[model samples]
Target: MSDSTVEDFLKSYNPEVRQLVLKTRAVVLAVIPDAIEQVDSPSKIIAYGFGLKYADLICAIAPYKSYVNLIFSQAAQLPDPRGLLTGTGKRARHVKIKTATDIESPGVRSLLEAAVASMTH
Candidate 1:
């Protein structure tokens, strides 16, 4: 999707939810500067990947009514010693970010680092 599409998606949410989504996007991009952004309106999420295909997807930012989710695509393979990621999916897991501070927390940063590192191996 286009950049404008993503911008519109972010704007579609309520002010509070919109702010959370913007913060989540900032955190993800800050952690993985080279990650390619994929805006999927059908799924209502913005995904970041190392390559053009789904297999290269590293994570995603999904906005809900109450919070935004930082979704790790290969969460099953990442190191999560803190047990912060929550999910029952075969390969994906998510960390809910309710506020801006959650994005800067050490636990969240570590997870983002691990997810990006996984792209090389």
Candidate 2:
């Protein structure tokens, strides 16, 4: 979808949550410029493909009441250092972001970069 579509989605939330979603979306798009990304309707969750060809490296941003959840669809397969991710069942794991600083962590950044790299391959 268009950039405005993404922006509108982010703006629908409260200012605090809106800013967090906007920043996270920027970082993800910066890493995966050619991502097959979309702003899903109904829930308005933001999702991006690591590459046009990859299936396992999609990242979706889901906001909770007090925090944002970075849902890594392929987290179960990625190298889990720092033990920052959690999930039940199988093949789904996520790292919760309570504040902007959470995104500043090296482990978190690495996870996003690794996802993009792995998908590009």
Candidate 3:
């Protein structure tokens, strides 16, 4: 996303949701500091990836009025021994983050790590 677009998107959400989204962004950046961040306005999401393609996407942050969802694209291939992931989609899975604590929960970091590691640079 362009700097203005991302700023506008972040400005649209409630403080709680904004906080969760930023927290997720921090985690994603920590995991892949060079990851590209983009906005999908139609889908209402901020996606993180290595390159400029959907196939290169690692995950996304979808914010709602009350919470934010951390979405993993290749969820089925990721190892989640702590079972932090939840969703019924064929390929994607999400972790609903309602609080800052959710971002620091068990398996969250590892899931992000594993997601990055699963990819071939």
Candidate 3 — which residues are off by over 4 angstroms? 1-4
User: lDDT of candidate 2 vs native?
Assistant: 0.74
Stretches of candidate 2 exceeding 4 Å from the true structure: 50-57
Q: Estimate, for each residue in 14-91, the C-alpha lDDT of model 1 and write its tens digit.
A: 888888887888788888888889888789989999887889999999998888899998998888888889999999
**Candidate 3 lDDT by residue in tens digits, 37-65:** 98988999999998879999999999999
State in Å the error of residue 40, model 1: 0.4
Pick the lDDT winner: 3
Candidate 3 colliding pairs: 1-38
lDDT (C-alpha, whole model) for all candidates = 0.86, 0.74, 0.88
Per-residue lDDT, model 1, residue 82, is 83
Residues 12-88, candidate 2, lDDT per residue (tens digit)? 56777776776777677776777778676676577787444336447888866667888887787788779988887
Off by over 4 Å in 1: 1-3
Q: Which residue pairs collide, candidate 2? A: none
Stronger candidate by lDDT (1 vs 3): 3
- Rank by lDDT (best first): 3, 1, 2
Better of 2 and 3 by TM-score: 3
Q: Please provide TM-scores, in order, for all candidate models, with all chains considered together.
A: 0.92, 0.83, 0.92
